[model samples]
Target chain A: MARLSPEVTALDTMPNSAATPGPTTLGEPTIDWDLSIRPVRELNQFLHDLAHNARPEMPHVRILHPNGRHNLAVGLQVPANIEILGHAGYFIAGMNQAAHITVDGNVGWSVAENMMSGIVRVKGCASECAGASAHGGLLVIEGDASSRCGISLKGGQIVVGGSVGHLSAFMAQAGTMVVCGDAGAALGDSLYEAVIYVRGSIHSLGADAREEPMQTDDLKTVADLLQRAAISADPQTFRRVASARQLYHWHAEAQY
Target chain B: MCGIVGLLVKKPELRRELGAWVSPMLDCMGSRGPDSAGLAVFAEAPSTDLLRYSLYDILAQDVWPTVLERWNANVDAAATLAAHGQQATLFSTTPSALGKDWLSNYFPHLHCFSVGHVIDLYKDIGHPRELIKKYRFAELAGTHAVGHTRMATESAVSPAHAHPFTSGEDFCLVHNGSLSNPHSIRRKLERRGIRFETDNDTEAACRFLEWRMSEGDSLEAAIHRGFAELDGFYTLLIGTATELVLVRDAFACKPAVAAETDDYVAISSEFQSLAHLPGIQQARVFEPAPEQIYRWHV
Candidate 1:
């Protein structure tokens, strides 16, 4: 694999420097890569190398002109902060651990699928399955999230400022999903041990998923998540939803 | 995966560059779809009363002479024909309804990709870039346009199975995902006397919209009804002579992005297609919500 020389000047000598915002002269300048000058494959390869290379401190990486390409910044395992300047395609930051990633534009499907830890934020809407099967971390979307936003989520906190599409949180094993706006049909279908809070109307709920009274603790959790997401919705108006536990254990006698 | 793109020029000054701008957008989506490609462009009609029909896969060396000879014998009207490759466009003063019926009966093998006063369709089985070069898409001028590059998940890779399916007069549709229940949907429409050109799933959706519009439902209403009826993942871009409509399925599994500026409204299956458009950096970009309909006048 080709490695970027350490002696290379950050952004001053980078190709397409005219389009880029220039190097991190004002802040911590660890690394800044522009996708406009290099293809997505090279970027992914560089990220892979960065995760494997041993260093004294985690590197701060900035990606520019993501342009809705798929599988970007996948499988990162470092304690770094990464910022994407434009929209990204499917699985923008999947299988991430100990990295903080932020997207200035929207993201395509499965923004943080199977993420083990860290934070991922989207300034714009996210496509379907925004955080599917993610086990840990905080995933935040300032805009709407499409269907199956947190399908089969094991553990995490997903906060969406806008509406969510159908069948979100379906079969989620353990997680907290907070929606500030309306939810589409069959929300939380066949849900398992996940809590959902919605401030707006739910089109429908899935089998074994029902609304529960929002306790004081639930309100506090929702409030904290909202603050972290930078959204200003009333926590008092939110409703809690969880699995009814009716399908937790199957019965052979019921099959007849 | 399939890629769909639409461009509606809001500024009259940019009208002539519609194809030039859209060609690059379509080319950027080459990786998403490599099986077949199609495009439909809307331009000024020669006459208000004349109806234009664009046909593909005519195959004959002298396509215009062969088609004109047969068509002129069937219909008595002032007509013009233009042919390139295996594709051809016909403009006739004959009533649109009568012309369509007669053409279907006489030219059963030819595919009428579009029928309208302002729309002309070009499509074939090849890569998007190759198709653009063959069709000289970048040089063609239009007011609005829609294009599709198909990956052929649901149908055979053939010229007849290519996208930009014409639904009603002055309207065409391009879809980026598969339908879960197209066979049943086709049966339902067939019972209603809606004819289908191919086994492609998106064609069923096109015909369904046509049937709904024929029953007096507006485009918005028909699309809403589609959300209730169709089962599957899809991001659809429907182009009419006067408007462009975008919609996503309730599941929103397929991806779509829209960018708008003072000059145009552009939609594509991914954002890279819109990144090269003029003033795109300042354009307001957003994902259309699931089951939500977005319409822009041309």
Candidate 2:
């Protein structure tokens, strides 16, 4: 954790040492935007203006004093590295594209909803509907997530390091959800092509959901996802969940 | 939405600063619930025979003298009283039930918000700023405290509807989230001869737990039964004289995070509320699991 001195101001340049170490950060400059003195709308306005501005390179921005306020960085398109210091509220990093955003604290409801691309990481737990109807990107939660984690997920990959509440991955169409910890009731209800991997107990499975044997390729995929999400777990210990395909085509034999 | 916060000091030296630390924790959740706010603080018990009851909505000063006169006439022991704005705290050597009976039988309009040896409650129908201005929360000192800011979801915004609802002696509960089947549960409790003060679902839940505890069940047992019977989303912070218990519903629609250190155990609706506490950076912070009761004793 990076500790900023109280006297440090926005004009005082601080290196982004708190972000997760990655290979891409070779020589890029990291900018710090402290939200304690400034309003939340400033960050949103900066991100919005960044889309039209012709900058030579993508900026790495660090945010402070998240204080559980809603809509911190809602619609960002630039491929910037953004890190929030404390808890944030709803719709954080929503509709993100080609950016890497990390929250150091818990997030409120509907985090990363309808995200198109990029990586959104939460170091703490998230409230309901974590990644609803997302197309692409990898959303990682290091802590528990509440109900409807991946509701109506389209093609995004979500990895939860801790347990998830009920109705997770409900009506998920595409992509995969990996839970290193337990999952609540109705793990995947009305699921489609998306796959779910759980290492811990599942209270109950939802409609048209069943456990499938993990193949070699599935293990590799789980391992890859865990590595990308920066979670440590035994890939072989996970059980795969997918659609039973029983409700794919209507049949008179499948009577009510 | 509603915000609930609880702080239980484990170290004796930090007891005096409990209220100062908790005031900011409650204020941080101002956006979650802007309608009304309340808090219950538990300090050292004054005496074994002395029972303290905090009352609200007393319009005139004569009401207290009349009640004290009537109470002294009925009971052999005399009572002492103090007033702060519309609220009053009365201390009597009589049994708690006797004091309650006197209030109910004589002063039907006055609301006894809390009745216990160590618990003193302060609440009002206003924002957190107004609550702070009316009741200097930082001036209070105690061992443990529970605070709530309610965002009128189930009932109207009023002082009586404010949270930290009390049913048992030295016990109060603040809740975040509405119950799906509170009316049905209220009916069952009403049949058991339990009286209710508000139409709030959290009060219904509090009364139900009180009834369960009265029926020879422990607090943990009563909470487990609540998990099985209660419907809808909730994250409840229940405070006793010496304990603070945190319980979340099965679905956990409401947010609750708990942080514990060697000096204190704190719970809030969000981590930001606990961020400013002393030594909170190194405290163990995590969200309580759904349907699991976590208790910390003083």
Candidate 3:
């Protein structure tokens, strides 16, 4: 339950701290293309180590990989800007915080699960549960988030620029979920406390959920989140759904 | 742990009878939580001063008036109106209540109060339809409600260990997922004289919300606070008399989906369950933002 620093670092001027002596741009943290690189795994390991030890003053970094590999930038928590030039598998930057991680290409499942703080932007479409059980951070999926994005979340914001698969937010405890497109079924089922804002027609509202009229306060909140997510929509156009407080007790007959 | 459903109409022009609309929606989600079922209705009472409480579980075939009198004396509740606009009666039965005839029997108590009906709780050892039929539940109704189907991960199976659990007056919660830091939070709450009935993580959530509400925070704000304090994977839905909220874990471990139509709003474990809902004009659905919250009001 460590709190992340609220200071935000820009995406340039990062340091290079790879284990291997690889080529690096002078002063700037971008990858040095001059050196003939080693195995993809070795290069990924070097880059991961570099990212973990990157200087705080340096704000930006870019890794250029010609081949698609597995487990790139695993456990990257450095407060710097990072970019991967090629595709990756499994967890890339899983549990990232502070660093603004950008994938130049596609990614595998669970891209940024358990992200405590900061932004993880996926440039391409992601696999299932892209940000599963993350806490206190912003995950921006440029494409669709597969099933269970932002499930069982404690806090933070996930803005999917596109649509999502089914059972998203299945057991979400608290956080704001904003889908620019349509959501799959059973959204917010057995939810404890959170707000869901959708701009399109809902397939169905789960049990204990009801449609609520938009008010000034609600509009303001939605507008703020849209601004942060870089989504453009009239706040008035969004419809909100939440639980109706009916099933709060078990009677003698209902007692099993 | 349980399934809950109900409807809320903001305008006086909206139809007052809620059973026809909310019942089907509740039944549709019966699979999410089957255990047991019960319904309660609340509205602008005819006599504003008379605080009428409808109790569902009482000694079977026993004198209800006597029980009510004793409960009133214990809690200092007085019978203000002998006969009023609509009689508020309590209905309860063992097993699950599902059939059409059994459901209709509960209609006698659902006069004017039948408007804002809420099947606030149900908990048992089986699926939703089985519990519904076993207990004769089609008669239940409500406008705003929340429910749950328990997988029984952290808590045991019992009526007390159900969703739509309450912590105080006007606060209810239904949760999916587990709470890792319940003991620390629970100890703090207990020190403040907050009593807890169940050992499940959902009650911890309810207590968290109640504490926030008691501290002068709105239900939505209290839920927001929970996002920071509560750890582990969880998808939570909270229901209050005036508002509804949904929160997703920061990692997005569980699943939840929602659809809003002009006439009806539906949420289910899968999108297929929402297929039967009518008049779907335009749907904009998405998952909750990791570690974020969504809230709406009536």
Candidate 4:
């Protein structure tokens, strides 16, 4: 594995390093292994056992499984780049922190659950309940994502290029959920400080989350999300959804 | 992953001439199918031929010989071909074929076929370009073709597991996505006397199409049936004698893009594969509508 040089780190920290072209300093520092195949159960067990006894030095993990494999690369806190070659089963690269993970193929449900930090990118589509209860870090789904993304999101950002399933951002706390495509029903149900910005129409908003007027702060957040997700779209075209105080702490009086 | 390219020339003499243009298109998608590469080229069927069958029947390996024997004895294929004015040829070209002996021994039906090269399907991944160059895949000619690069998950990765898999017949299919309902569909198709060699969702798709055709459904109608019945995320590209069809699953949980040109149309899992095709004055590129089917005739 190639080590990230101190000079590259210095350049990344500098404010005016944009003049240099090509190869941004911030991708996976190293990637180990080439194309190879392993059974689903065997690969899952290997990743599980490795996560338990993983050392700091093992910073790169490459997996080659085309068929969906459930529970691959769960509960790892090391700083590594785990790349899954093809479409994977549920909980792929789940509960990840410090290390970055990339799936060259599509992913199944609950990707990056309870993740504290680091990045989880899916080059293809994602199943429902993606990024459920995630605390911090960035979850980028290049393709469309199913429902319940960032549900109960305590922190971090989730940027999806394509349409999302129903109940997205349900019961979210502090954080942001950006959808470049249309969002499904019950978007941002009973939200707190978390902000939901969608470029397209919402099927239906949840209990307290109403259509809030787009503000300058909301625009800035949406712009940042679009820039990060690599989707070249105008930020002014989006709408914001925030919790309405009317439905907060629902009691007998508010019962309709 | 391996790459496959074929062109349907309006005229017979133009068939062999299409090799130059078709090679690059196939070479471009080589990244999708890297294990083994092949082109199943077909000349125009004789105008008078009424019945032609491309069979991809998977049974227990032990029952294969008996099934073939029964099929050959029960079916009067030569008389049918003569009545239709169509000449049929079959080739089993793969890395495993040591010599022409394998062809003569197993398939006595085929008279002669030109087999200059066959690329090693195993021990190869992430080397699509090198493999294409080695096999001189650019020189092969055909009217319509399908190609696949195996990323083996449910099935073994071997020459036998390669894509553009026919039912040993004319129908070919290339698929991108998983089938959540494989077990149910496989069992149903099996009971209907359909054979399955690979456990991949793609094989099921082929069998389903064949079964529909057998039940007297048109190619387009069979595809529509597949869209409604099949489950899971899929982007299916199917090629038959007269048309090329692209179908996306209801959810479209995977990626598939199509680019239509004045002279030809290309579809792939990604855009880079079809970017360089000729006469693409206005690239009509878009994602296939969810649960919608698109068909192009040759």
Candidate 5:
């Protein structure tokens, strides 16, 4: 239970507790956009326009009253530090190139789908497919993730502080995933080159996925992800799960 | 895809604002289901013997007054009607069985959406943004409500196909996904002399669960039996006289989020619909787990 409630290290860089508009004690100017007053289209349009002309410094943009709107801060190619003050909707930061996004509350499906690079952190639980088909970047969930947390991973690192639901990381082709807590059924299925480390119980393994002996490199990898994710789990307690390479080749004798 | 929303107030004073709070939620879900919409509201019973029947007619929106006057003069004199467009609520001391027969015999074209002492159902074939205004959903007041917007994946788009399907007294259900085994379940229930209204899959699930409850099983027990009986993806929300219930299928592929606070409990297919909730920033928001039963009593 203690491991599941790991501290979110993203708070260190976030604005003060107020996180309101205007300059904070950090001296960084904040731009406020309230969804209750303005429409989501205006916010996305402004963010999209800014993506073309890259700003020099870290423009601290604050969005309030998200009310679960979809596609907020998507296709971001800038280095702007954006903070969402409440719960958000699906695809909050899809196709994110190079931006630092911090969600203060829970999020809907696909927080950072197909991200090429950058960091997105969630302070609360996430729904299904948290980081599906991401080619690059890092996603950190400080709480439990629902089913298919990282399904069909294409080269992204996902660190889940708590449990992940069934069929997580299905048909993964690359990258790594670290679960500090329990994993639901079918941890990984038909994996290719993607690696998984679970510190707690695994309900079951999917087809072609098997537990392998943890090596020195595995320990180093888990240690690095845990350190970066701000989770307090020991590297030595995790078990490695990877593909068995049994389903890579088709055999005529195999029964359907 | 479809959309589902349920709200239950914990305080008595909050009951008056139930419609005001839930109207925006239904409008937010208009994007998910643009073809049709439906809502079921649960309020306090006027009396133990009083039954409220929601009647609908498509031929004319103003037919409710004539139907009400005719029923008052011919069927039950003590019965009163609160008509709203084509949708009308008949309040009477007559039992539901006799009430159904009376409506069927006299007004053959009028459809009975629901019959209960606390539930009032309104459904139509249009986007939620349009239907909410047409049905005057913002003026209603209740302790709890469950609403649905349908996309009509495999069925015809009609008011009857809309959700919040009720089978028994003071009970209604709405679903967010499809069922693969609805025909089989319908066949099984047909053998037990259960009649159906439409070919939609959600109605099959609604009737099955309500039938299980009629056989002396609690809603929780009926849902457990539903685990083995119901197949395919679903996020079901049910509203009763005194409680609101929610559940998802084994896969839980269909999305549903719940926001809970000291004042109320709200459930929706996505967090966006619940963004307007009170104390939303401090609400204990979380995704409901698959095959789990979450219930809140009024």
Candidate 6:
């Protein structure tokens, strides 16, 4: 409630309360929300209130024509199955607890930022800072992610099917990032315990981050993540990137 | 934050729809920026000896007709003008520099923001929707258009300070990010006798890149040079007589998504603006990469 509402203007976010439940097509409870006329806040508000409702079996929520709007499906605490039909905007599926969200198209900045649990998937590309500072969750981007992706990561797992731009995973504390494509400049700068697995070429590595020989557990991690994301990639081609731990303490006297 | 949008139509039939499509695109981005808005349209150039100048005086109330009458009497008797809101498009056989000097010397309040064979400019301080309505942007016909919705983070909110800053003929640029070293760059350009119209930071970048093109570098080469000279976070969308070019800084934190169909190429800071475009469902949608220049010709 403290952040922007995105509903006050009533410009593109007009309410379409005339949305009706389906005629039982999928065997599970199904509901449709058309974002071309329906407000994004109403969808998020419904998702927020789903935890308090009495129905233990959640309906499948499908969003159509998101139009790159900001703050969609935010702050979900229920275990509902949500699917976005088209491109959504920034901070979509942010702060999730136990829901499974799927985006069939590209997303804007900060997709699934600060998630505590559950899964978030992007079938297309993503903008900057994907899965940033999440306590726990499984996030997937099937295409290239822009710069500063996964910066300051807490304990999230990010799997990218395409390359990541420059300065990805900067100052990451913990978690794992498996990039199926090449990494752009300054990958894993000032890194800590978080590990990175890149299958393609690396532009460069940041301060104190170096490539280590892959262990058996790293292959298992990559394989498990790619399987969960439903992407096909060879685990043997990936290289491990982690912290060198040199900047943990500073030397009092050093040459400039 | 600022919102920048660009559209270039490939098919001749889509030219008339430029204003109608771009107006809603700029209006929807009001969430990111709201203080002011501006638009620069590049129509098919007239095969005449005349040069076109887009002039503005936001403080004046219905002064375009009077300005046109005086220009005909004092500057050029053959000068023809089309007055719209507080803005006007003047067509004359004189050199553009002569037209600019006349505006500066005689009518100091009237600022010529654009001078070209194919470009027409309009900008104001208000909601983007109001600017769109006042200027009758929906009826405009153009080969391409570039627009900006600004929050006035660095300079004053005025018609001059609004975005879509123009430089050498038929060239305009709209920026979505800030520059850390605009003053230093301004000083460097000023040393070369580059006269600036405003102290806004984006003007420095526009003038710098346009200067590079003036020095015989191609647009792509100038942008590569800009990568070395300009220091900041920026996603610049430049429109020329025949092309619309887009580039993001090294980090590319400022977002921009583009959707290209057979009929048109549409770009916005975010995708919401382009959601309603024709055949957008079948368009090849993608995000512009870092430091890469993407150019689509009309």
- Estimate the TM-score for candidate 6: 0.94
Tens-place lDDT digits, model 3, residues B1-298: 2333434434443324344444455565555555543333333323233323332231134344654464355433543223211223433221122211232354322211111123234334455555455544444444444545555667676555645676544446767677899988899899987767668787887888888888899776877788889998777776665556677776555655555644444443433234333432244334355556666555
Interface RMSD of each: 1.3, 2.0, 12.9, 9.0, 0.8, 0.8
CA-lDDT, candidates in order = 0.85, 0.85, 0.57, 0.61, 0.86, 0.87
Off by over 4 Å in 1: A1-3, A6-8, A11-28, A223-237, A251-256, B45-47, B58-60, B69-77, B97-109, B180-194, B224-231
TM-score for the B chain of model 2? 0.95
Q: Rank the candidates by TM-score, best first.
A: 6, 5, 2, 1, 4, 3
lDDT of 2 at A34: 61
Q: What's the distance in Å from true for residue A2, model 6?
A: 32
Model 2 misplacement above 4 A:
A1-28, A124-127, A143-146, A200-203, A215-220, A230-237, A248-256, B58-62, B73-77
Task: Rank by DockQ, highest first.
Answer: 6, 5, 1, 2, 4, 3
Q: Estimate each model's TM-score.
A: 0.89, 0.90, 0.47, 0.51, 0.92, 0.94
Candidate 6 docking class:
medium
Share of the reference A-B contacts seen in candidate 6: 0.89
Model 3 has a DockQ score of 0.02
lDDT per residue for candidate 3 within A1-256, as digits (tens), equals 1111121211223323332333333464444211124454554455456555546465455555422344556566667667776444457677777767888655556777888887788776565677777777887777777766666766767777777666666666677777777876666665556667777766666555567887898799888877876778788877776655444554565321
Query: Per-residue lDDT for A51-158 in model 1, tens only?
Result: 677766666677877877788888888878788877788899999898899998888889999999999999988988999999999999999998889999999889
Weakest 10 consecutive residues, lDDT, candidate 3 chain A?
A: A1-10
Error of 3 at B212 (Å): 1.5
What TM-score did chain B of candidate 1 earn? 0.96
Q: Write the per-residue lDDT of candidate 4 for residues B37-66, one digit (tens) a residue.
A: 444444455444333332222221333344
Assess candidate 3 and give its lDDT.
Answer: 0.57
**Which residue pairs collide, candidate 5?**
none
Give the alpha carbon lDDT tens digit for every residue of A1-256 in model 5.
0010111111222434322222233443456666676677777776666567655567667777677888888888888888888788899888888888888888889889888888888888888998998888989999998888888899999999999998899898899999989899887877888999998999999888899999999999999988888878899999999998888999787532
Model 2 Cα displacement at B104 (Å)?
2.7
* Docking quality category of candidate 5 according to DockQ thresholds: medium
Clashing pairs in 2: none
Misplaced by over 4 Å in model 3 are A1-143, A146-256, B1-65, B72-77, B80-126, B130-141, B281-283
* Residue pairs clashing, model 6: none
Candidate 2 residue-wise lDDT, A126-189, digit = tens: 9889999989999999999988999999999999999988999999999999999999999898
List, residue by residue over A95-198, the lDDT tens digit for candidate 4: 87776888876676788888888888988878767888889888999888876778888897899988887778888988888888999878887788788888
